[model samples]
Target: MLPLTRDQKHLVDQILAFTTDHVNETGPAVFTVYGDAGTGKSVILAHLFNQLQTAARTQPNSPLTQTTNYFLVNHPEILKVYREIAGQAPHLLKKDFQRPTTLINQLAKGQTTADVLVIDEAHLLLSQSDHYNNFYGDNQLRSLLTAAKVIILVFDETQVLRMKSYWTEERLERLLMPYPHQHVRLTHQFRMQASDALVTWINDFTHGHVHHLPKDIGTHYDLRIFNDAEQMRQTIVAKNNQVGLSRIVSTSGYPSTLDGGKHYITEGHFHLPWDQYNYTSTPWAELPQTIDEVGSIYTCQGFDLNYVGLILGPPLTLSPQDQLEVHLDRYTDVEAFKRRADITDKQELIAVKKQLILNAVNVLMKRGVQGLYIYAHDAHLRQFLGAK
Candidate 1:
């Protein structure tokens, strides 16, 4: 059973009431629920799914029956789990189910004319762009809209990472303009401590604006900064032993200053080099290995853990200028063009990268339920916390 936060329960009630009222009166409509990462957005989706399933089971044989289908839309991680449950090879399932066209067609044929299409991670929907094209033309949201009477998309625009065309207010408006759309902004964060501070900081850093939350209502975790990786790892080990707190190391697969020891957990059990670019493969042995540990943050996104130890590597720096220097090479695929791009100036690129890295770090830091231990490799960056 999935646990629902108070806000999530409220959102589910709203969705159920809306669906009940509009089950008979709709050709097509879109409902968008947007929030930051680790904000219980997915829990709301899960609760809605449960409600819809119950309605389908209990309702009489009526045309207004609920035909609900849930998809996390193109998340490789979720897809792997789904394949395992179906007893199919991951590669085979990828070939069959990875393409939106194939999956949608299969869903259409198998399902009983879906009344609601719930799409998680909807921020990945590509905007109108020529340089970068979604395999399905136009937008995936539009395609899903064609198939379902009520299309519900849940995503955080701020969490978009790999898409060529970033999601913006203008782009969202344009996409839903043709249809009757209602936008629901989720402001209450039940997951993170210091929610207001984190949200305000991230919004200002990325969008050049600030939006405030009501109050910081959750538990607070200590944000510790360390200059050396060895100290950080030792601290993590000690913390685990002292408090019996579950802990895991989350890094971008880079060696710390501790004599070339890798700080981050890799994907599989194949013993690949730490510097290897590809980190996608997962062996059967590694599956259990992941389960045994305290749970690493790199793989813990879209899920929750009791405690998290985040090792912010050299790519992140909080400088004396009160500016963040984030190196994008750790998280993005644009490393190849860095050599020749007009914006080749390292300082300028570092500034941009700093903001990006800070946002990502903030998201990761907020994922813990009980505690967060931050280990900063750069001493200058450590000073920014100011005795936190």
Candidate 2:
């Protein structure tokens, strides 16, 4: 298990105390952890949930001795990791971890409630019914909130990638307005070794701004901009061979289909298929064979990598003013911008689509803990990025 920082430890202690205090309360209690990527949100949830389970199951003198609880995550890749961890933990069982939809369905069938629910990647929770996932609820979080006495969740609005699960601070605040709640924002980045300037550079770049690269960008982190996509893949492969967990990922505007066939992402000589759905128990990044596959936001989100090679795909272009532009026509991820009944304004819909595209870029760029290597499909954008 990963050790927590002093502040993170204090967060755990505070949340545990809050849970104990609200266990027998009349209405449901909510604890919302707000943080960006790599802010150690998931690790805090992991440690806190473990302690809750250990105390509820083993500590006879503790107030949580008999309290029932569950740990949930909307991402399947992340859920696999937690369940694997639980398999080895003495106090945590595999059954203790589940996807939010699964937990919600089971609770509905049994008409039962849990004392506590700890959720990771809560931003991925479905805000609308997704029949493909068998979720019939209007909102997964609302369902979970209704079924638990206390809900502890970590959310990042920037990580919201799809229209089906679109979220904002305002939307979340409105949902929790009826409940008793506590909110905390964690600012320190615990994953990347990059300096604050480099972090800000990435944020600005994804948010549609292009600035000259910082001179000290590589002092603490490996920052590289490659003119050749093939060379970038070679460097990432070498890094993977040396350090493990390094993978090449791309933005969504690639040739892809959901027909269960191999869809290749070819940039010059760097040709490989997009990451296939993993049927095995191991996480995608941990598999040695995955180094040849190009990961997407779905595979890499909420997971850390030693190094990431990012391909800004066809949808992104550089304007005359050097501003970054997103073209909806070139974006092939049709499912990402599916029309929602509640969102009907044409301008709002376009803005959301562009933001989602940028959100995917932001997520891929932040996956690297030690380094970020970038390549762009647009020639002008690539030149702009590589110039500095």
Among these predicted structures, which one has the highest TM-score? 2
By lDDT, who's the top model here?
2
Which lDDT tens digits does candidate 1 get at residues 218-322?
346444545444545556566556554345544442532324544343332312222211145452213433423323223454545455666656566655675
For candidate 2, write residues 1-388 as lDDT tens digits: 7998898899999999999889878658999999999999999999999999999999999878888899999888988999999988999999899898898989999955688999998899999999999999999999888878889999999899999999999999999999999999998888899988888888898788888787777566998989888999999999998988999999988889888999999989989999999998888999999998999998899899999999999999999888889999999888898778988899999988898999899999999999999999888898887733
Model 1 / residue 171 / CA error / Å = 1.5
Q: lDDT per model, in order?
A: 0.53, 0.91
Candidate 1 off by > 4 Å: 2-7, 23-26, 61-68, 78-102, 105-113, 126-138, 193-220, 237-288, 291-298, 328-358, 386-388
Cα-based lDDT at residue 210, candidate 1 = 26
* Candidate 2 accuracy as lDDT: 0.91
lDDT of 2 at 209: 82
The local lDDT score (0 to 100) that residue 212 gets in candidate 1 is 33
TM-score of each: 0.69, 0.98
**Model 2 — which ten-residue stretch has the worst lDDT?**
211-220
lDDT of 2 at 279: 92
